[model samples]
Each structure stands twice: as structure tokens, then as C-alpha cells.
Target chain A: MSEHQYPASLTHGLSREEILNRLHNRLDEPRYEHCLRVEATAIELAKRFDQDVDRAGLAGLLHDYGKEIPVETYKRVIIEDGFDPDLLQYGRGVWHGVVGVHFIQTEVGITDKQVLTAIARHTTGDPEMTKLDEIIFVGDFIEPARSLPVEAKARKAAETNLEEASRIELENTLTYLIDARKLVFPKTLLTYNAFLTKE
Target chain B: MSEHQYPASLTHGLSREEILNRLHNRLDEPRYEHCLRVEATAIELAKRFDQDVDRAGLAGLLHDYGKEIPVETYKRVIIEDGFDPDLLQYGRGVWHGVVGVHFIQTEVGITDKQVLTAIARHTTGDPEMTKLDEIIFVGDFIEPARSLPVEAKARKAAETNLEEASRIELENTLTYLIDARKLVFPKTLLTYNAFLTKE
Candidate 1:
């Protein structure tokens, strides 16, 4: 409770490719490439933040690891596997994220808490954004390949101050999700909220 | 994904006492008691479904294990734990159910995927529930302690037809969450939505 208390998946030091190989074809070719792009973006942010590039890259690379399952299977797996299916029903598809973290650690045998924590949190980026977690999150949405108008500013911030860049990217992400009437993953808002307070 | 993968923390298999002990120290004393009561409720539901009461009981007892964290910590852990905060902001406090599964397996080391899944989905029972998952979910909400006008009927359904009873319970629970201005966890609604399609 004092620090980030996590198990193997959250902390193991798996490289991006190692994590991708561990994905074991869960993702199709396109999604895998997207993850690879996200990992690259995350690495850029990591350099800016002076964070662990490997951890950030891995987190970005594996953010959607559980997403390969059809939405229906998500619920089925949660029920059959004995997880809460409600997570699958809602916004930003967190059940996969939650389940992905577990799968990576237990099934894949990666035990680096930092890497897992980054993956666990990249979607909603927590209040206390560890350098790596923030990088992976912002990098996910604003990587060079992304075509968002906000990316330019986000890119600029990443080159200067990472926390500020993450804050901007997260707020923008929340705005997009909210405007879309999408289920705003609370952590995204929480990340935004936390950023607001910090700023 | 094919056979339902769970982590070693989840598959380790814990005794009821160990489960309670973990909950007792981490959660409010009353909530701990609620867990025990849910176990009994789950046992009765197991009877209705002709499922394994012991596994149902264990799942019921630990459904809200993550609820033990103080609100601040719960907020932080779940968000930092990687759940999209957008999901949380929808006013669904029920996330602990999903988050609980992750915690039990990763941190607590109870690895039975089914057990963790059952606990995760208990708040918003899934549609394709395992015989065991359904039993435990029904038990958690309608346990002898819950006080609702339809509680008696729900209990009887556990005796007569579990699937039917679950359909009713899920309906009422979703309505209650909606009425209370709470965000419905998608998985719960998916379960409810899926059941709505069936007989």
C-alpha cells in the first residue's frame, strides 16, 4: 500500500519484442503492428521523461493484448475464466486491459511489476504517473503516426516536460472519449482530474 | 483464450479461512461478514443449479475482496492498477468486482481463474456464467442478509431455477444501479443484455 504493490506481471522487465512474442498470436497482424507503433512512440516519450524505455515500450506494445478476443469472448472468458464481465460491457474496454495484465504475468511468465504496471495503467494513466506509464499512455495516442490535431502540441510537450505532455494528451483523450459518448474509462478522467490538480 | 487462462496467483486454490483472513484485515469488518453471508447465499444458489457449492462459496466470499482498500486507495489502486478511469467515472463503483479478480490472482495468489472470474463478475453477473459462477453470484446478492422486496423471490429462484433467478436478479440490480445514477459496468449490462435475449 505504501508503494506500488504489484505482482510479477506489473514489474517484470520484459522487452517489447519479448512481450510481443509472448502475445502468442493473440493479436492479428494489424493490431500487432499498431502495438509496435505504440511501443515506438512510448519509447520516444520515455527518452523525454528519462523513464525506462523498455518498460514503456512493452506496456505500449501490449496495451491491447486482451483485445484480440472478440467482444463476446471477452465476456465469455470473464465468466468461464471467472473474471467480472461487467468490465467488458463498458468504456475503453478495460476488462481486456485488466485481464491482459494477469495473462501476461501468469501465463506469459513476465514478472516485472513496473512493466505490468505501465501496461495496467496506460489506458487511464494514474494520478502518480510513473515516468514509464505516462510515456506509454501518451505515446499510445499521439505517436507520430497518429493523426490527431492535438498530437503536435502533445509532441511538443513530450520534447520538453513529459508530465505536462501526458496531462495534455490525457485531457484530450478524455475529451474525445466523452464527446464520442463512449464510456470514459474512469482512470482517464482520473488521470485528467489528477492532472488538473497538479497543474 | 481457448481454455480460459488464469495466473498462478489465481490457480493456487485458497481455503475459506485464508480467504476470510485476507478480506478481514484489508476490508471493513462488516464487509468481511458480508462476504461470509454471500458464501452461504452462493451455496444455496449452487443447490439450485446443482453445481459445486464449495467453489461457489469461495467465489462469493471473496467477490468484494478488493473493497477492503480505503476509498482513496481503492481509487488509486484501480486507476493505477490500469483500469481505464473512464470506466470508473461512469459512476460504476462496481469496478471493484472486476478489479478484485485481478487483485486476488496477482497480489493474493489465488489462481483458480474461475474463482477470480466469479468474484469479478458477481456484482454484474455475466450471461454465459459457468454453473459455478452463476451459483456464487446469486448467493452474493441474495444472501440471507440482503433486504429487498424481491429478495424472497430471488432466494426461491435459487431453489427452483437458477438461470431464471439470475435473470431477475440481474434485471433488478441493473435497474437499481441506473436509478441510483450509477454507471453500469458494461460487463454486468452485457450479461444482463445477453440474458435478456434468452428465454
Candidate 2:
């Protein structure tokens, strides 16, 4: 793949076709399909929430770009990027979103801070998420491929009340993590606290 | 109430009768009964875990001493004692444990830091909970009057593995708070993280 296969600009102005082409080469077919669904869901959410649809779509398309990387390579990227050292204690499930930021910046040449923040926090969520952040976060959870029992209610809630939908999704995710005996990254708790207290 | 009704010394050598007398005057009948159940549960856990039964019982008896105080009085105590200002943002559900420490210290004259820390953290756990802290925290949840479905599993786990019991209790509490749309105190998250990463 030539360097031109990726976006040439930092503003994330690439069309959907160009973004898909780049993602297609980087991810296998099934994973690539998930990204497309996430992008479509994110755009719908953005429209409902009055956020910039283009940035949401871009964030969704590129959210899991680092998931395909080798674990050792992701570890190196996490250290080189100067993320919180405590992040090293978690596994790939938590690392992908964080390490994805560095991968997108270096490999995909997408540097929009809002887009980067959305990608960085898409999986676990940050305490202070913007409307765009909520769009991508909720969209990734309720995307078409997801089949959790709560997804239908979450999708409906997303259309009517984004904050409530986000809160429910966070609660569901934290419950799953605890039941599975997996480590929960601290930012997920911070995000839950933020939504729990929101007006 | 007479001054002798409260503990006159810092060592917490007050007899169970004395403690019950003080609690009876301060709390209503049902609340006072709940404290008695907690004390009983705590002593049983302490025996299983090889901790000080007397200290655990004292911590349990005084755990909710501030619960009966008026909300405005607890708020005043919180600020006057220089507790975390962020505590002001949370409602009474989160205040009583924190403000109770000051009331216990000033009114009851019990200055043992371990007992105070256990009382302060009983409602929402601290990250660095000792065996004694775990006894009180789990005991309060699995006490007889508490009939939550998870409490039985938690009680059994407390007898076998205190850490596992504490983790289960925290997960149950956090899930309940989230489902009820209540604000989760940050320390609760810290305790969850600590347990998630423990061996």
C-alpha cells in the first residue's frame, strides 16, 4: 500500500470511499465491516444530537485501526506515545483504543484533536466527553453487529436521549467486565461517574 | 444524652452495652437494630479471618453513627472538618460515612485511626482496605436485615475469601448505584481497581 492510500490532510476531509479503502487494507473483511457499521451508526447519532456528522463518521471508521496491530508492537507504541504508565497493566481489549490514537496519527495522518480524542476514548470513554465523543462511544456499542440484549433499548435511547443511552451502555460494559473477571481501566470509572451525575 | 454514654477513651474499650446505649439514643429502633446485625456479622468475619474481633465489632457498631444526623448538620460537619470539598457535590447518601468520622471523633472521643478510617470508608470503600476494613465493609452488606440476592453469596465468600467477598460486594454496590442513577463516589472506583489488580 502506497502512503497515498491514507489521508493526505490532517483535517479529516477524506471522503467515505477513501477512508474505507484505507481501512480495508489495514483490517480483515469482518473487522472492516464492523467499522462501517460503527460509522453509519455514529453519523445517525450525530444528526440526532446536533453534532458534526463528518467528524463522527471519521472517528467511527478509524476507531479500531490499532486492533489489527501485534500486541508487542502496540505495547511499544503505548510507551513511545507517553500514555499513562498504568495502561500497561491492562490487556489488548483496553489497549486498542488508546494505542489506536498513535497508530492513526503516525500511519493514517489524521491529526484532528477532536477526532483523535474520540478514537482514544471510544472504547473506555473519558470523564469529559463532548457530544461528538458520546456519539462515537454509543455508536460503537449499539452498532449492527452487536447483539447484546440491551442493544435495542440502547439504540432507541440514543435517538431520544444521548446521555441516558451513554450511561446505560457504560453500566452494561462495566457489569460485563466485572462478571468476566477482567481488569477495568480507571478512565471507564471516571466516565461512568461523569454520566451518572450529569443533568 | 450523658457524656459517659459515648466512649470516654481513644482505645475503644467501650463495652458492647455501652456502645448499644449510645447508639440507641442516637438512632431510631430499626437503624439501631441494623447496626447490631452489622456488629454481629463483623465479629463472625473477624474470627474467620483471624483479625481482632473487638475492633471489628466496634467499627461495625459505629459505622453508621452519623446516618441519623440531619442532612444540614452533616453538611456543616463535612466542611468544618476539612473533608474533600468534592463531597459537597454528592447528596446525603455519600455524605454520612465521611461526615460521620468527624462526629465520631468529636462526640464519641474515639480517635483510633483504623476504626475511624473503617467508618469513613464503610459506605464507599477505600483502595487500601485492611482485613479489618474488609470485615466491616462486607459485614455491613451481608448483615441479617439486608436481603439483597447477592448478599448470600457475599456472606459465604466472606467466610472463605475476604478479598473475593469484598470484590463481589463492591461490584454489587456499584451496579446498584448505576442502575438507580445515583452518583458513584470516586473512592469506590479506586477500591474496585485495587481488587481487580490484586493477586
Candidate 3:
């Protein structure tokens, strides 16, 4: 419960409590708790990486805003919003982030482009991630609730170099998706190539 | 050495000995032997599946025709042939199959559409596979020389059902590629979806 407490300064137009309340209304219990952990972790990462802690916290809190939406709604929003047609081939797992942007824009009224981009890319990261983007992405992967073996190394890496940590996290995620025989989104490939081939 | 001997009846247009001589001249020793084993396995599969044995044999023999080509040549051929622009991002590992069809046509003069298609798809299979294509693809994976444990199951499956064997073989290959952190060709995903999600 103490972890749910947010800093007074961490507000993107709406109070932290208001954002959490909105997210709670949309997500189930476990997902809501995960979002809280991601927010705390993203704030910490942002501090270490010299990014805007408030922006990172907001982005993490709302990243999965569209997760609980009905599949039909997601399909409708994707077409109505003019999202890439290729995304239709993938299932709801990949669509939530894409649909989350529109949801946050209309419902949450958080018009910060950086926050919106981070939310849209939280699931399958984009090739060019801002520092805040890296913080939220790495934080989401290494949040305290997650039990991945690489969590310790990733956390340590984030403290010194968030981009390196983000690369490792994306590599591990791509490997896991492949191992599970899941369909890989093309954007995930672009992200992987961008990270690995970076100078 | 005995494996190098092809049945006289297994010739497409060129004599079996002539085809082997041309293949042997172009391929290194191990590659040449692998091609022979694939041809033998393909012929057996073709017989069991009631496909054209000669076409399968020819396809298997020439499947890797572009493998030994210089990387520069592969790149040049890919561009000249107007292959999917996305293919350039992958290395020669994925390009050999795309370039092989052109090579087989001009260099070896094997103009049989079925044989050429089989060769083109031998690396990363197509969504729509003919019986001959399945024979060559499965034969290349479960050839006598391959030490993979799945080889036995695949060969056995091929005896009873070629398409089923192809699905198993493709699944295993995709898993291995993921394990190795290799870049997966898009066609491989299409082929996987085609088989796994077939009605």
C-alpha cells in the first residue's frame, strides 16, 4: 500500500491519485498493482538516467490503459484511428499499446506527446526511444513484482546506462516470445535491430 | 560414396550422373555429400507421398545452388532480381534460397517450375507448399547426415504424411533459429502460420 503513494510533484495535468483511479477503473486488480510497481520503478530509473521522473511515472501508470478494453473495441479504434493495417494480423496482446494511445488521448486527457509515445510503445518498443521511453520500458521489465532471473542485472545496468539495459530487456523479450512460439510483431524486430546495431 | 549414386530413372532432364557432376563441381565435399543425401531422402519421400520423384530429386540436388556463391554475388543477384527489399537486411543465410531460383535457372538450366520453386523454398518454406516442395524441405531437414534428434520423427512422419512432417520440421527449425538469436525471414513466419493455423 505504501508503494502506491506517489510524489506530490508527479502530476501530468491530473493528480497521481486521479490517474491511478482512472487506471484502476479500467484494469483488474493484478494489472493495477503491476502498473503501480511500474510507475515506482520508472520514477527511480528516470532519476538515475537524468530523465523527467514525473513524465516517466505518468507514462508507466497509463501504459496499459487499453489492456482491459474489449477486442471488438480495440479493432474498431485501430481502424477508426488509422493505425497501421498490418497490426490487424496480430492478436490483442500487441494491439493494447497501440490502442492505449488513443484511449489515453481521449479518455485520460493526457496530451503530452512523449507520454503518449511511451504508452504506445510500451509493449513493442519503437526503434528510436527517448530517454524517458527507455526508463519506462526497462522499469516495466524489471519491476519488483517480476521474477525474471535477469532482473538483477537489468536493474544494475539501468542505474548506469538505461539504453544498454533496454537493449538487454528487448533481446530477452524477443527470445522469450520466440521460445513460446508466439507471433512476433514486425516493430519488435525493428526495435531489436536498432538496439543491437547501434554504434 | 554409394549415396552419390542416383537411380537412372530419377533424372529430370539431365542424366543423373551429369547432374551429380555439375553439382559436385560447384559444391564443396561436405556440401556435395549433403546434397546427395537430401536427394536420396527426397526421392524416398516423393515415392511415399506419390509425388514426382525426378522433380524432387532435381530440386534437392540444386536446392543450395546459391549457398556457395560469394556474398557479393548473392547481394547483386538479390538486387538485380528485384527480391523483396526487406531481404537485404538479413544476411546470406536467408538470401541463398531467394537467389538460388535465379541461379538454378540461368546457371544449371533447370527450368522446371516445380523444381525451381522447391529449391527457392528449401531454406524458408512458402505458405503454400506443393507436395514436391514438402518433400525437398523435409528431406533437407531429416536427411541421413543430419544429427538432429527430430530427424527420426520427421522421416517417420514423412512416410505416412508429408504435410504433417513438413509442419513438424518447420516448427523445429523456427524454434532453433530463435534459440540461436538468428534473424527470422518473413517467409518463415508465413510458412509457420500457414501450417499451424491451417483449417
Candidate 1 or 3, higher TM-score?
Answer: 3
User: What lDDT tens digits, residue by residue, belong to model 2 across residues B39-67?
Assistant: 87887888888997767877888898888
lDDT of 3 by residue, B77-190 (tens): 778878877877877677667676887777666777878888888888998988788888898988887776688888777778777778778778766665565666767767
On the 0 to 100 scale, the lDDT of residue A157 in model 2 is 86
Q: Judging by DockQ, tell me the better candidate of 1 and 3.
A: 3
For candidate 3, the clash count comes to: 0
- As for candidate 2, its clashing pairs are none
Task: Looking only at chain A, give the TM-score of model 3 against the true structure.
Answer: 0.90
Query: Who wins the DockQ comparison?
Result: 2
Alpha-carbon error at B87 in model 3, in Å? 4.1
lDDT of 2: 0.80
Tell me the DockQ of each model, to 2 decimals: 0.02, 0.59, 0.23
Q: lDDT by residue for model 2 over A20-126, one digit each (tens)?
A: 67778889998888888888888788888788877788888889888887889877877887878788888777777877788788776788898989888888888
Each candidate's clash count: 48, 0, 0
Give the higher-lDDT candidate: 1 or 2.
2
TM-score of each: 0.45, 0.89, 0.85
Considering just chain B, what TM-score does every model have?
0.81, 0.90, 0.89
